[model samples]
Target: MASHSSSKIAIYGAIGANVAIAISKFVAAFFTGSSAMLSEGIHSLVDSGNGLLILFGVHQAEKPADARYPFGRSKELYFWSLIVAILVFSVGGGMSFYEGVEHLKHPAPITDPTWNYVVLGLSLVFEGISFFLAFREFNKSRGDAGFWATLGRSKDPSVFAILMEDLAALLGLVIALGGVYFGHMLDNPYFDGGASICIGLLLVSVAIFLIYKTKGLLVGQGVEEETLDALEALARQQRGVEQVRRPLTMYLGPQDVVLALDVEFHDHLSAIEVEKTVDELQDTIRANHPEFKRIFIEAKGLSGKQRNPLAPDPTSPQI
Candidate 1:
């Protein structure tokens, strides 16, 4: 719950900054006729819309389970994150690239770059603030983990998505400043168009990276291998258990996981003893890892035999 609140904070900050930046950029682009400034305006507008979409996804994902969806709607966030990536690639990157090509074909000089400079400088400060907030929240979640490693392992997309967008925005601002300065100094409009093209490429690369990260979550990625190994060891330690197969686990949300385990008990254990052992194991697991929202335990006799005739086939894969 705390993490969710923090993520929302970062997202809200980014949305506010982007909205302000977009308006100013559009105004400056209108007056100066700078291709790079126009592209940056579109980028900011798209980013604002993406932030709202992420917030909607987070709200929907928090819905309680219903008969139609027993597992809840936690995966909705992943779906929306995928949509955000597609929007960045198509609306943001595609438009910027197209705009740059058009500008190059019929180049026009900027008579006054004063408005462009003012808007770009203000945008830099706003985007910097947003980036700092996102970085702080993400850093809190990561603890001592390295930045790239934490990003790869993170399940929450709102914070990381904002972080990535702000990074790209900052870089694009720098590129736009250079384009304006150099085009004015050299009396050449090609430099401005080239900067827009470079910003388009940067946005495309960021979108691709976001798509790759969100894909795994949507496809039911499992817990870390070390986590699985620890769970298996814990199951094996329980008395009356002869062997324990590796457990199957999948994250339903950032803090929700579903776990399944197959345990082979001694043939001599009575029905009551087996029941007690299963109950104890479940309690132990819940105490150690509360993130597991659902747990299914399958008990089997030694030598691949079912303890009860009604039990599932022992030869079939349980995990």
Candidate 2:
């Protein structure tokens, strides 16, 4: 995931593009009476609103940890992301399906498709720009991974959320274009209605995926595997650490991680030595993985500890 500032650029760019496109599409839908265009308008409007909602989430998430809510409001982003998914699915997708079915029932003749074409063409350009911006920012966190992998592993939802919205908008525009053109050619408004329904289904799928990811993050996802490995290595490198237990990690936010570790010290280490080793291990881990906002280490060996399945014992005990 990109930093908070970089994510904001993507969000703001999408908001500007979507707002302008929504207005134009609404105007065209009004003048042309095209069901496809109407659905497209709703899609863009919802996208714009979702961008605003993400911005609000960012603001709420940045609030410092307080006495009442000690972990900070970082999960606010996850909560609002869930809200965005629900809105996109229910309002944008459901409304599109409704309008499409209604048009299919009535089969009202589309008055003029010229305005629909114009609006769709402009929308394609603006949405493409937004998508490119989002994709670029998203790629920063992806590294050598494929697009699908990057999307699945993305910690920050705002970037991928905008990416999916823009992609859906572009596809919806194409479907709308085909519906308008073919409806005029074959003189069948059913084609337009069918296209709208297809667009709605597309949006529903995207919303479902977003809902799944956001909900997972809200429920407390963990740090990357590489980071976890690094934590274990750091524990083993400590001066008096005899064995390293499994290092547990969970995210409080996109960039915030809470880590818990249990380490077994040397069999006969003094209390002072144990304390020194614990402090040094913490400092090293923090220096290596700054994402760990809170780190807790427990000396499990002499504290009447139970043998943990996850810990690895060294062949020979050191210091």
Candidate 3:
């Protein structure tokens, strides 16, 4: 997971690059009448819009917890990320696929490809810069983890979204360049349309992958199993804790987690002792795992029974 500030830097870089590339690619597409170039233009435009949506999500997710949203609005980032993926699939991929099919039906040879090459070159440069920035930020978060593992475990969507989009943009630019070069060389426009279709498929694949990743976060994914195990172990070390059941945890944001621990204490402990133990355990856990913003302990007697159901301990806080 990346800090919000790091995520913003990557997204802002992508937005700036995509906005410029989209304009130039559209101009080139209009002049050359190349299907692939047009598809690349649409891709850049969609990426630019996605970056803006991600920024909006980050802003909304930053809201403090209130009466209406006790967990804060951190998951708003996930919701907007889902929306961005849908837009990429429906608008970017669908439009490109439709345009490719239409172009294949009536193949139009490029009259002049100089502008196409120029735009593609510049687009590649800009997209590369964006990709580099995003990859760098992501690397900081991933640490020693492998790419696929890090991606699967990552909670922040903004960094990965921009990284994937920029990578796709770079690949799309290559395809468009190949289409323009070969279409002109072989005098076959079908190749250009085929390239557009390839780009469309690429965008769709990326969108689906993103949707799968974001869906888990939107639906309240928990912290890793290892984290839960470590937390349980820490709780078991408390002075009065007899048994620490497995802890339950969920991520509220990239860095926010809510944890619930069920612990069985010895029957001999007094209410005051229980309160002191709970407070000490919470401090220890917080010191170790700062991301666990909310911690609730369910103090249990021997054999998973509450110490007393008739009246709760006044000094012991549940949250």
Best-performing candidate as measured by lDDT:
1
Which runs in model 1 stand beyond 4 Å of their true positions? 307-319
lDDT of 2: 0.85
Candidates 1 and 2 compared: the better one by lDDT is 1
Model 3: CA > 4 A from native: 308-319
lDDT of 2 by residue, 80-143 (tens): 9999999999999999999999999999878778899899999999999999999988988888
Order of candidate numbers by TM-score, starting with the best: 3, 1, 2
Clashing pairs for model 3 are none
User: Model 2: how far is 129 from its true place, Å?
Assistant: 1.3
lDDT of 3 by residue, 1-319 (tens): 3488887999999999999999998999888899999999999999999999999999999988777886688889989999999989998999999889999999999989999999999888889989999999889879889998998888888888888888888988898899899999999999999999999999999999899989988787898888888898898888878888788788877878878877889988887788788888888887898887778788878867686322222432232
TM-score of each model, paired residue for residue = 0.92, 0.91, 0.93
Give the clashing residue pairs of candidate 1, or none.
none
Model 3 lDDT at residue 164: 85
Error of 2 at 249 (Å): 2.1
- For lDDT, candidate 2 versus 3, the one ahead is 3
